[model samples]
Target: MSRVAVLMGGRSLERQVSLKSGARAEDALERLGHEVLPIDAGPDLVERLSTLAPDVAFIALHGRDGEDGTVQELLDVLGIPYTGSRVSACISCADKVLAKHVLRDRGIPTPDWHAFSETAFRELGAAQALPAIEERLAFPLVVKPAGQGSALGIKFARTAADVPMALVSAFSYDRKVLLERYVPGRDLAVSVLEDADGEPRALPIVEAVPNEEDFYDFEARYEIGRTRFVCPAELDDELTGRASELAVAAYRALGCEGFARIDLMLHADGGELDVLEANVVPGLTETSLLPQAAEAAGISFDALIARVLELALNRA
Candidate 1:
């Protein structure tokens, strides 16, 4: 087999989660008979990789330095093949505002939202900006950091009074914040993967049911048994087909390669679908939706990891 490096534990808020993902990936790669080297990604990642010189890199990094295309670009410069999207796709998908713009431009149906930078908010002052934000996206809005993942720095505001605090929390994580019209509905996730022939295909749809929280926050996502996932989600054939198609469309629109997970909300009416965001490097932990969907498609964890590595090796 190939010499594979499983990169994990970057200097991001999601470092612990990434470490778990990396450990799981490393175990799977080893099970598939690959020579695996697990690397705890840090400031000296480049130096460590130069020394290990693995044939391929399995990126299990989440958030900031890992998922925001920084590590991807570094891998590109080192001429190392890594699983998941390239730098450009990673950069675009990492930023919620940019991803939404791309989706809308591609005729994809994403939720209507407004984005503002910390500088603009400070200059305009909360008094001026808050009213403008409310006017743009009414109450029952989702406020989040534009560049974070796993639902970090996310808050739900049901009234004008809640907006300021949400903005503060969001700005703490990113200078840019997005306020999206909250769509009340079923939380669904679709995984898209490129086959051996390089054709992108959508896997089974997954419905996320948060056990305690109203939304799937970081805790609900990583905490064991905190969320119940219904794979091949209880959606009717038509809804499932549409969601799968939309997932592929979003994946292609973002120019993603290897695999990505598209998050969508099926309105409570069970008709409309609103694309939320695209995750270039989806979580690989035991609780991740991708693996659950893969299992439903009859692909074991080892096989799925092997296929991802194959895609990385064949990537142009």
Candidate 2:
């Protein structure tokens, strides 16, 4: 068995959640007969990693520097193989605008979006940007930081009146923000993992049914019972298969390897489905979407963790 170091708990807004995912991953890795060490990533991350130097690094981090290629860059410089996408892929996926552009260029179905910076919004009256955005993306748009995870700095706006507030909230997280056309319908996520044959394997689709609000937000994601997870998404076999294919396509289009989660919307108007965004290091907690998908695939939590470790080791 390989000695593995699972890194989590970074200087990001999702530190607590990362801590929880790391703890669970540690337990799972140990159960799989592997030697494991759990490290809380911080400003001293490089120093701490140098001291532990394991066979591979299992990154269970989410949000900010954790998912935005910072950790991957350090691992690359150290010549250590870690789980998830490479530095370039991680950075590309971390930026919502860039990912959207890549997906759109590939003829993949993604919501229309416009990138706006604070300087542009404040100095240049939103009229130019607003009209352009209005022409492409309609009302009821989604405002989100171009680089964030775990639902932080995400807002659903119904009218232009909500633009200022949404912009401020999203800009608070990152300098770049995306205004995307909101695709109304069921919220679903598809997890993709590369099989031993080096081919992408799409897991079962997971439907997110909000218990209280109209959309699944941060509260619904972390708070217990705030959302219902229906495995296999209760959709027709055709739609399920199509969604699964679309998800894997998005993953490959973004050049992500190991594992990733693709969020989608099954449009309410019976139109074509739309891709929301992709998560490179999807949450590994007990309640996260990837774990839930694995459960539906008959892979126990321990087995899922083992699979992730196996992929990391083989890639190394």
Best by lDDT: 1
The pairs that clash in candidate 2 are: none
The digit string of per-residue lDDT tens for model 1 on 238-302 reads: 98899999999999999999999999999987489989999887888887889999999998888
Over 4 Å off in model 1, which ranges? 124-127, 212-226
CA lDDT of every candidate: 0.88, 0.85
- What is the lDDT, from 0 to 100, of the residue 270 in candidate 2? 76
Candidate 1 local distance difference test against the native: 0.88
**Tens-digit lDDT track for model 2 on 1-316?**
8788899998888898899999999998888888998888877889978888888999999987778899999998888889888888898899989999999999999988888777777788764667668657888788898986778788877788887788889999898898988887888899997776568888999998888864625445546777788998898888998999999999999999888999999987874688888899999887888998989999888887887777877887
Candidate 2 Cα misplacement greater than 4 A, ranges? 123-127, 213-223
Per-residue error for 72 in candidate 2, Å, reads 0.8
Poorest stretch of ten by lDDT in candidate 2: 214-223
How close is every model to the real structure, measured as TM-score?
0.95, 0.95
